[model samples]
Target: MDNAATTKITENVLKAMLPYLRENYGNASAIYSLGQKSRAAIENSRIKIAENLKVKPSEIYFTSSGSESDNWVIKETLNPREKNHIISSKIEHPAILNSLKSVERFGNETSLISVDEEGFVNLDELSEKIKDNTKLISIMFANNEIGTIEPISEISKIAREKNILFHTDAVQAMGNVKFNLKDIDVDMLSISGHKLGAPKGIGILYIKEGVEISPFINGGEQERGMRASTENIASIVGIAKAIEDAYANMDENINYTSDLRDYTIEKLLNIDGIIFNGPIDNRLPGNINITLKDTKPQTMVQYLDMYDICVSSGSACAAGSINPSHVLRAIGRSEEDSLSTLRLSINHNNTKEECDYVVEKISEGMKKFKNR
Candidate 1:
């Protein structure tokens, strides 16, 4: 049920990518016919993606991953030596937070606007934090852990009024929630293919036509001298097809998952000491993050895995360190409670029966934990 972390690539996406993997294998930068075929595929994918997002194809820049896209925007846009500030929320992905460290190292300022108990950004605080030196504002379109969809239009309006550059990490929101770049008015945006049923290691950075920023990766001409690297043609084709499929079935998928999600929530809440973590409204359709009182999330995860059910914890596991999730903490969860969070993200492929089995196993685990 951990669709938020990644999704299984659909057959349609796989079929579209197969040609690039087999017959169309060639360097997109080369001059041979085979290479030109790859190039043509890339351009067609770009146009299709642009049409889906309601933006020009020229605005799309492919990157290795969403993290790379986020880093490119933060590191390339704000010159460390310049007296400038960038604003983001406390609940953003590590990609944004870690990149901001470079800004602080150079004596420049960064403002982390706080979020409310439901994980929505405090717009008034964001507005108050902006100063004369504030040059960029990057908030996420939707949070990955809690599934809280932020107010994108309002945030863009705030940035527009101040003439500050606005960016959003839409990695989690790309196929799940549809928004038009022309209407949202964001200067830049980032998305990952893996989150939307394409393979990992492919992402997109959408830059408004007139927006100015330095190149991220430096090498021989590629990505129009903006990002330098040979493209992964197969994954690029996969992402394009994945997005097309997602858009076509968006409403049906939304309705199906929304109903299953509400049903699952009702069933799971029957367990004593269970509590919901994220907002009930303005939330993603297929997400259910919750805390099971007095049970460690890691232990619960293992217990469920034994029954062949997969879920994710709210704790961050990096290197050898395991810490409570910054997301749960930002939303007013205590440290111990934060460690008890379990993220259950369902998709269209999941059925109500699977959710019932998951709930039954979880209920059994909670009982076992309580008895112990």
Candidate 2:
């Protein structure tokens, strides 16, 4: 149920990566035939990924994770000395927010535009915030916790009109949304492999060709010198396979998960005090976040876990934190309501019977907690 947190690597993806991990083990940077084979595999995977994204092969740079990609774009894309202001939404992931905070030391200022009750960015405010010094706008394509897909194309347009660069952390939207960068003017985008059923270590940074940005990591010429460190060949192959699989079955997966999500939401909301969060109809297909009145998120999480039903209070990244979710706060949820929020992210493999079992357990927990 916690598919948003991380997905089980697809069996096909795993199999695709196995040869690279074993018989074909070679340093992609070396000059031997074995190494050349590894290099060829990496380039082939990159081409496949580029084809999936409908972008040129030269624009894609493989990174270690979405956070690194987000950080690279936030910290590297603009010159702090010249155009120093960056615009972003208040409900952005910590990867974007924390990167902005770090760049402040270099004299860059950040404007965090507030979102609406449904987690959509206030475009007027964003337009109003852009000044001569506003060099970049970095907003997420979707909210990981609340599952609200933002107005990405509109944001891209706003950035273009201002002649500023646009970047999106599309980590959560990769497999779930209809994301073809060719259709939008977004300057940069980020995606993580694990979110799409690949291994956790690989990610992609799609830098639109001609978008000028200096390299963040420098050493042993890798990622066309944009990023360093030896390539993880197996994981690269895994990501390509995972993405291919995800797109091939995307329509069916979306329909199945969307139906399961709606079913879960209906049953869960029937509980006396449950309040739905995020955009009801416009959210990510498999996401269901709700506030269970008077009940803490951790309590329900544990209660559900007892029955082998996995879910989350919020992002898996912020798993053990005691603080209220920043996303909920941005949408006007009180600290207490944020604390009581639960996220149930389903997938194609999940079924209505599973949702029913989860609902039964949740109802039992609510009653038990009410008594205590």
Candidate 3:
């Protein structure tokens, strides 16, 4: 299942975007009727996204992607305050962790909390890391590689208790899990549309009310000057429609996908020398990360590709790299285990027949590798 990286857009979302691309094209800022119509469509999208997130429309800032949103929030939150310390986990996506690297150049102090064997942040260590100078705490809602779901609400509580702002990169969790911004009490969150069967280049950053931060892209006063560009009207509408549909069907999707995931995992484990990674229970519904003890992940990925069974070695963004997964390393995996890891992320559209095909391909590949 390669769906964790991106999903095929739903028919309804595609239809929702067509008019804007064809007949309704207009600069949202113009005073003309077409412009007003475009502007209204953008506002409607904002309202729907805000309603789903349980936040005010004003708090939702449309962004280009999850990376841009993560970069914007981290840079803005840490730059304004004299306090330069930040708290994050070792297993955060490069969007957050790499952004933190740039923040450090501005003389900011950073505390990276270590994760346990399951890729979960140690809450006790997280509490110890926060200090008076710690202005922001950034963590991921779920890992892209292993699908380890973090304790965001618990971490948010800690950040609230210490009066520090908290942000979560919820790109992987948004459509797959039940989330309410109010319930988490987080100050900011980031999610990308492609993760939920919408188009790429569209995402949302939820900023808590009254949290003043600088804009990432400087231009005309769009997104209240927090982000500035002519609205991506069609994609924004598509995102809103996709999120609504995903949330509405979340329960059924979870049940179906989870069954597929379990079936695949059970079949894989029946083979010799296979080990699963991440928390068995506290993980995403359709994620199954496993390692064949002696085979390299890249080799297995290539073998599977030949059989038309797509999978990933780590994060899709990092798939081209020769380096082992940082998330696996953080969870105390050996180099051998890390090199062998393969991630299979399913979705509602995946079928049992597809699962059987993948298992057959994997078993065949492993047998060949063992012989060699």
Candidate 4:
């Protein structure tokens, strides 16, 4: 049920990556024939990813992780000399919020836009906050905790009219949601391989043509000089294959998972004091975030784990901190109520039996905790 945190690497992705790890193990930057083979493979993977996103290959720049991709766009797009203002939401991942903190250290200004009770960014507030100095606007494609999808196309239109650069942290939305960059006027988007069925340590940052931005990493002239590092060849190949597999099975997977999710939500609602978070409509198909009254999220999570069922209270990045979720707080949840939240993210591979089993454990735990 914790598919949002990460997913098991599919067999096809591993099969595609093995050759790069063993037989084709060569530096992509080198000039030798073996290195050329590695370089060609990397380009092929880039092309495939671009095709999936409906963008040119030049727009895709590989990075170490989704965090780095988010950091790169923020660091590269903000010109401290003139344009100092940035706009984002309060419900963003720490990657965006923490990077904005760094941007503030350099005397740049930022506006943390607020979201509504259902975790949707307040579009009117977002438009009102934009100023002439606002060089960039970064809103995530979806909420990781509550699974509310944002209005990226509408937001992009607003940014375009204002001539501001638009970006989306799409780490959670890439494979689960269907979108094409060519149809949207956004300037940049970020994706993480591990969020789908690929391994960790690989990500993508897509920048539109004619968008002038500085380089985040400076060295070796790699990633078309926008980012500098030796490419993780195996991981890169694996991610492309993972994405390919995802799109190939997108419809079936989404329908199946969404059906299971709806069924789970219906059953879980029967538990006393169970209140669902996020809007019922326009949310991610596989995500179900809810709070149980009179029970702490950590306590329920611990009890469920003992039953060999996995779920999370909030973002995995924010795990281990004994604090209320910032995302839930942004949506007007009380601190104590936020502590009672649990995020159950189903995946395509989960079955009705698994969903029922999870709901049984959750119901049992809620009853056990309430009596105590």
* TM per candidate: 0.97, 0.98, 0.98, 0.98
- Write down the worst ten-residue block by lDDT for model 3: 75-84
Regions of model 4 farther than 4 Å from truth: none
Candidate 2 ranges with C-alpha deviation above 4 Å = none
Clashes of each: 0, 0, 0, 0
CA lDDT of 282 in candidate 2? 70
- C-alpha lDDT score of every prediction, in listed order: 0.89, 0.90, 0.90, 0.91
lDDT of 2 by residue, 173-202 (tens): 988987789887699999999998999989
Considering summed lDDT, which 10 consecutive residues are worst modelled in model 4? Answer: 75-84
Model 1 lowest lDDT segment of ten: 314-323
What would the TM-score be for candidate 1 when compared with the true structure?
0.97
In terms of lDDT, the best-performing candidate is 4
lDDT of 2: 0.90
**Cα lDDT tens digits for candidate 4, 1-372:** 999999999999999999999999999999999898889989999999999888999999899889999999998897667648999999999999999998898889999999999988888998999987899999999889999999999999999889999999999898888888988778999999999999999999999999988898889888998888898999999999998888888888888888889999999999898999999988888999999899878888899999889999888999998889999999999998898889999998899999999998988888889734
lDDT of 2 at 143: 94
How close to the true structure is residue 37 of candidate 1, measured as C-alpha lDDT? Answer: 97
